[model samples]
Target: MNDGRRKVLKAGVAVAATLGIPFVARAQSKPVKFAALLPLTGPFAFAGNAALEAFRDATEYVNEVKGGIGGRKLELLVEDTGYDVAKGTAAFSRIVSRESPDELLFVYGDSTGLSKALAPEVARLGLPYSATSFSSELADPKTYPTIFVLGPTYSDMMAGLLGEVRRRKRAAKIALVYSNSEFGKDPIPFAKAQAEKLGMQIVAEEVTPLSMPDATALALKLKQAGPDFVIMQGYVLTVEPLLVRAAKEQGLNATFMGTYYSAELALMQRGGPATNGFVVTYHNAYWYDSLIPAVEKIKQFRASKGRSISYKTTYYMGSWFVVDVLGEAFSRAAKAGKLTRAGVVESLNNMGDYNADGLIRSMKFVNHRLPYIKLYRANVQDGRFDAITDWITVG
Candidate 1:
């Protein structure tokens, strides 16, 4: 009787194992997918490419180190927006509907206008989004709770430049040159207000389309105004030629200041002698100095990839910041044993004081905006930007 019972038990266990019950359960793997919306093939391609590389690099590093969550590798999907509202909307729809990633790692767009348009859709889908936009409108917690910004707001960067303007005693009689797009238009009002508060008068305000070949007309107007300082805002295409040609032709002696977007080294190289002594607000710590531990790691990453760390690498820094924050949200979701859309959104809402590599001071779901601001004053000389002051932090 005992032998018969033992044989029956052994046979039952073997059958269960052979049927893929216990052993198969041990081999089961979780699935993870990450997707991003970026302007890969449009006006903002430069910034988008850098961000994309950063995300790919970081996730690759994480997977190589066996740091995936729940035994699942992080997968990434990317779509191009071209920095156009309609295009951005369509790209976002394709990813959310067709690809259907578990979470969004980075939605890279430099323009606040495009971000605003897509933020609503992201919220509608209840997906967490970490983006590179600093438009103040996106700061509202009620509006875009699932979205966060990795860079300082445009107004914050502008405020830093204004501080330098006062330090140089050019708060009065300053001319403003900006592009005619949303990126250029986003900070105009805040900058004007700050100018008034600092007793700096905006003597002349000029607009040039992002597609304009030359800024001659704007430069001529600026030269005619003869202001003590000239502050310009625009992407590289417009700002580079304007600053170079304006300084060359007008012999402009004013203290030149630029928004963060004007801090491209490529533009500075093109400006050559004209861009010397040109100061622009910078968001990230210098990528080359490697003085800080965070910068050192970024340098090591650049070298490993056979790429030189430049201001462009900060795009990677910005993108990495996005992933780190989103990772935190996902971690919270995983620990809670639920991956529902509401659960992730709640985790993002309650996020507090999370910093990735010191790139960001703090990011919280406070008022649905990450109240993080740090700015550095950098001037272009010898084909590169040299930091002129200690990093500045603003609210």
Candidate 2:
């Protein structure tokens, strides 16, 4: 060692010994970590469980397939919130308290309620967050700077659907059916404004519980409206089939449509012939689609562990996709030597037209949310939602 440097080091050690202090060398860098607060064991367990599975596999995919983030392994920290807002809030605090600010750079939230509740905290921390929700309320970069929707917001999807309606038939009469919750109510105002902008009439606004016990009442309202199209929101498989059958039986004869969540195969399979022509918007490639290179990679990801590939929900596809997107930010920031939460967000905001190997199409983020989407129609005989339109940027 150089004499000057050696003398300085010796003097530092002597000072530490005199003060009864321990001298320690610099600590090694640790793996990158992100928190996932999911609803793994409650009313939303079906969807949450699927997301959990995807995150686990995505962790593996990142560490093994993507060669780790910036040469450091990626770690996913998960918590179950039971699909309750209060439970989710506590879990969010627990995760924040536990992880070092340097490591916990992002979070994947389970629902809209939790996203709203945690908005201030997440933005204050400057850790980028994405959730299963596409609520337009969370899309504002000003109010919630660090909170980003996974894909198109519900408002964007509504605009796309409404625009398509105008294209097919100008000034189409539209009916809106949504649950009585925030998920249902969030996009209605924007949908109405966009409908009016496109010269379409909002003939009816039918509201139901998240799980409607019966569709007889709703069917009557829809039939009375005589809308050119009936768009259902805030429902998955439940109430969808019931409404379809009831509406058709009532001789309503209006086309039914929905957003991404309603684009599940289970919806078509369970709804049967009644859901044959039902349409919805989606932001990712289906696992069954052979042309996507990323879909093939999904198969390879599973086969590496000697596991057979089965049909995974879009919940799985979405959760898997976000982790990779976050990994990209982590990598970019790490390489630039500013691998902090803000650094990651800055990198992500500038990631122009990157599509994560076609998980979605080439697109740009507007207000931190990808507004590009495509339309799909349920082919009940095939038990899939076939793409009816190419990717289109909306709102």
Query: Could you say which candidate leads in TM-score?
Result: 2
Q: Tens-digit lDDT track for model 1 on 1-395?
A: 99999999999989877887755664334445577778777767888888888878766655554366445556677777776778877777776777534444334444677778777777777666655667767766677776666556677777877777788784478887787867777778988999999998988888776766666666767778888887777665456555656656866667677766676666565666676677777655556656656667666766787876655555666677676566666666767865556666776766665655666555553456544443343345446667776656655
Q: Each prediction's TM-score against the native? A: 0.83, 0.93
lDDT tens digits, residue span 74-117, model 2:
99999999989999999999999888898888988878888888
Q: Determine which window of 10 residues in candidate 1 has minimal summed lDDT.
A: 100-109
Write out the backbone clash pairs for model 1: 141-367, 141-368, 171-200
> Which residue runs does candidate 1 get wrong by more than 4 Å?
1-28, 99-110, 301-312, 336-353, 364-382
Q: Determine the C-alpha RMSD for candidate 2 after optimal superposition of all C-alphas.
A: 3.3
Best candidate (score: lDDT):
2
Per the 3 Å backbone cut-off, how many clashing residue pairs does candidate 2 have?
Answer: 0
